[model samples]
Target: MKALCRDCFWTGDEQPRRCPSCGSMRVVRHEELGVLGIAHLDCDAFYASVEKRDRPELRDVPLIVGGGVRGVVTTCCYIARMSGVRSAMPMFRARKLCPQATILKPDFQKYRTESRRIFDKVRDLTPLVQGLSLDEAWMDLSGTERLHGAPPAVTLARLQADIEADVGITVSIGLAPNKFLAKIASDLDKPRGFSVIGAAEATAFLATRPVGILPGVGPVMVQSLEKSGYRTVGDIARADLRDLADRFGQHGLHLHRLANGQDSRSVNPNEARKTISAETTFNEDLNRAEDLEDQLWPLCEKVARQLRAEGIAGRVAHLKLRRPDFQIVTRRRTLPVPTQTAKTLFAVARELLAAEPKGQPYRLIGAGLSDFVDGQEAGADFFAEGERRALKGEKAVDILRAKFGKGAVVTGRALKKE
Candidate 1:
């Protein structure tokens, strides 16, 4: 087998404890290292890392990026992770766990700027890079060996180092033949890691893992799978096709394929986002429709801002409610035309909210826009004159908010106390 050093990017035939060229202990050896190219790159502790990068004094301190007494954590540094502070954990619990940790409100605009820089670097290597989020992406580097004068592994190692050097943060890389395995491999190691999973060993590798490891298998699905005698991936991998199909329909077939280490989806750089939305968990559940509407307005504004940022418009407006018991209720409406304005999003979602059964307290409220089209399409001949007015008015406010501050403009409904 051959080995490579992540630090020095030195390759040698004999597997050793350290790199002979650089004498570094960060050595990785695999029989199928060079050929595998489909890769997933995840920035380590993205928001917290960016925060620490900007504030050198906090480099060694535990840092968390989130706010609000009731809001869930957005992200936390590895040091905070040691103290049981995790993303999406309640802010109160996080404070109890890491009392000394420095918590900061999220700076999304700054983070997005940094994200573009990082992604641009990846595009330098391969235009096939598909961003899953601001902090993570999938890349296809197949057939680029001659261009870079090295295999995908070596090029990726160099890219990883380049990212850390240029961006001032570390990232982990997972190299595999397909998307499913690649995603799993990325999380095997933390902070700065490089893991590889080959097609040859994928089946045996996934067999022992729990069914919950597979995508789309939530807590409820896990229970259903357990009851169906499918506790592990191996069970599903070996299950009779007809039996699985009879029991689970298409979902069973999907589980069987993924369990056996198969993912046919290709890397798509132009993959259109299906939705742009935001939601907040309330400090306390409220049963009143008026209170929910107050919460819904901010989320509509948020989604509209996101849609505008992405230069897209959605023809579908959606509303979501989660009860105290975790039961979810969703409502959606098709618009006369696509829109990317807070007023339109709010109007559609507010109407949907009014139609839902009354007297139901919801612990969470979310709204989003989907069924997208380019922003240019929003001005089409078929576009309603009212929607055009709403978009124009919202754009003017967006400009004002950008120049002045987020508080530059506020709705009458926005003043309603939570």
Candidate 2:
């Protein structure tokens, strides 16, 4: 067994109640701590933590980041969690649970700024960083012992220390042989936690946990699994794979593999970004397409800004509309060539919007781009040389916006009032 003190970075041959050097009980022990390199780093109550850090008055108070009365909770601090406040719960319910909780609307701009700073720190640790989202990432720290002069465990402790000292935020890290287990362990102890699950005890460890603990196993699937007597990962692990496949179709095979810790998926560096999208729920649904288009233009610019920032492009443009009744309608069109241009995305999306029935009110409307490739490889049309020139002009406009400001270049289409 190997043990390390998170406080002092002391290594020992065996687990101890407290670190010999620092006399701290915040010790982490693992059989493969030095060897395993796959890590999942998740920030602790990310949005709420940021809010508390900036507003000292909110430190001891329960905090919730969301919208008005009709909106859902985006996130809540640990203090609010004690009162059963949870993410995605309706704001009405959350307010009822913890009436004292200070509701704050999401500051996306601030969050993105802080997230980039955190991301830079993670990349400094290893280049094999795969960002799962703005708040979490997977890191592969293998084959770098000589460069760092310490194992991944010690290096991770140092990272935890740096984050708290410099950023005034905390993160929980999980170390395991694979992404699945690492992701699971990251949640075991949160708010500055470092937990590990070694290969030897992986199966036994999973057997005791509920199948709902598995990624992608939602509430509906959990109910179906319970009806089939597959309440725990133990049940899934013991069941015949062919039987599971026969019952649940393709998903069954995945469940079987994950149960036994048989995930072979590599930490892909070029993880093709699947989607770039954003949506907002209005205080009240709007019926007029003009008002929606007023909102849509900014969203298209946002998506385009993100795409250009990442130096990526998309061949498919998609439009999503959610009615007040919760019915979601989506439409997509594949372009003749990939693009990262706001103009291209907005044109196709506007066409899609025109095709939809306009009389019905919508609570939410979103647009996105997918089927990605390098932006540099896009904009070349085989038949239309003029279109290519137009795209080149668009690229130049994007560069100008990047150098100057977003308002520096606004398309004529966006200026037209619907």
In order, the Cα lDDT scores of the candidates are 0.90, 0.87
lDDT of 2 by residue, 193-286 (tens): 9999988888899998999988789999999999999999989989998889889988988998899886777777678778999776767888
Per-model TM-score, in order, reads 0.93, 0.90
lDDT of 1 by residue, 1-418 (tens): 3678988888877889889999999988888887788999999999999999999999999998887777679999999999999998879899999999999999988989989999998999899998898899999999999999988889899999999999999999999999999999999998799998899899999999999999989999999999999999999999999999999999999999999999999999989877788887888888898888888888898889888888998999999988887778888899888888888889888898888888988888999999999998774646488878888888999999999999999888887753
RMSD of each: 2.1, 2.7
Candidate 1's C-alpha runs over 4 A off are 379-383, 415-418
Q: Candidate 2: give its CA RMSD in angstroms.
A: 2.7
